[model samples]
Target: MSHQSGHQHHIWVQSHHPVKLEPKLPQPLPKEPTFYYFAYGSCMCPVDLKRSLGENTHHYVIGPSILQGYRLGFYVYSPTRKCGVLDIVPDPKASVKGVLYQLPWRLSEYLDKREGVAQGLYRHELVNIHCQDQVYQDVRTYIVVDKLAEEAAPNDWYFNVVLRGAVTCGLPEEYCWHLFNHMYNLQQRNQERQLRESA
Candidate 1:
């Protein structure tokens, strides 16, 4: 099948069967039923998510959830925070505690912007999550592109924000502690360097 800009390439075709290109729609159509998102990072914080989505966030119903086979990690650098942001790393024996929210399908665009999709910093991916004995499939979440960023320790403010969100969502104390203690103290390390420089 021949590929072109803004055209759908056909997958099934034999030498005898000529490939028929599907015409592009003049306008995009909305797909239903609802949009569900899994927030494993600071987005799990209602305060942060509200700040990101503003009043649009009111359209969502949110609750605590768990994503298995992934663990919380600090690696996505936040220039504004001068530290790393939260990301989920795949692990065979670990799970990440997070929040699950359902919103109107249209609101995905807003969330996408907040996550810097256009900037190529993060991308939306669908994954399964478990909440309250229910398993949710095709729940979208933001994940950092591999090999695009260097791992860095999160600063105090960034770390606290993640901790606060985890606490707010009532994630297990053990998990919360692990999150709180696992991050590196780049701020402190810089302070020590400054002290040494002065001496």
Candidate 2:
């Protein structure tokens, strides 16, 4: 992707990296602190995020966004859902589409919690988002720190959440097609497994 003038983005080549703490907040949190968060997984779905983050989800204003130099992967295991979650792996040749949400800065801590950041599952990092023909710098996002040795395909319901969000946000049809094919294959295998279990 061509870099726009004055927009210098960090080149993240490592898929697994160390965790870092958020910058310490001043004694009194700024009133109405706001942040731009890039959601490239289930969080891309407002319903999914609100299920965990609660009703204040109204605070999020989402728009279609692109993350360059990365590819979405499903190696982040979720103990609660007993399935895999989405994470972006550094890919010099690919770009992933999702949603960019403007949210209150104070909610970052809660988001980190929802992402299991404190458990060393995922780490918070700054990502570059391209939206509205502009490059947004230092946008916050989560990256998996400990990926499962064997990648796990997401369940149908979970994958549907991402598919719905992608379509709702008007992502390119080509991208949606790619996800749809992947989901179809995974769902078929899962159904076969159910048959075997019943047998």
Q: Could you give the C-alpha RMSD of every candidate to the true structure, in order shown?
A: 14.3, 13.8
As a whole number from 0 to 100, the lDDT of residue 191 in candidate 1 is: 68
Clash count (model 1, backbone only): 0
Please provide TM-scores, in order, for all candidate models, with all chains considered together: 0.73, 0.76
- What are the Cα lDDT values of the candidates? 0.74, 0.79
Which stretch of 10 consecutive residues in model 1 shows the poorest summed lDDT? Answer: 6-15
Candidate 1, residue 35: lDDT: 79
Give lDDT tens digits, candidate 2, residues 1-199: 3574324333242213313312443434334778898988878778778877665464474688999999877777788767777888999999888889888766778899998988999998798999889899999989999876755778767888988877877788998999888667766776788899999
lDDT tens digits by residue: candidate 1, 76-149: 77666666777777798998888888866666788888877888778877899998899999999988775235
Among these predicted structures, which one has the highest TM-score? Answer: 2
Stretches of candidate 1 exceeding 4 Å from the true structure:
1-33, 56-61, 148-150, 184-199
lDDT of 2: 0.79
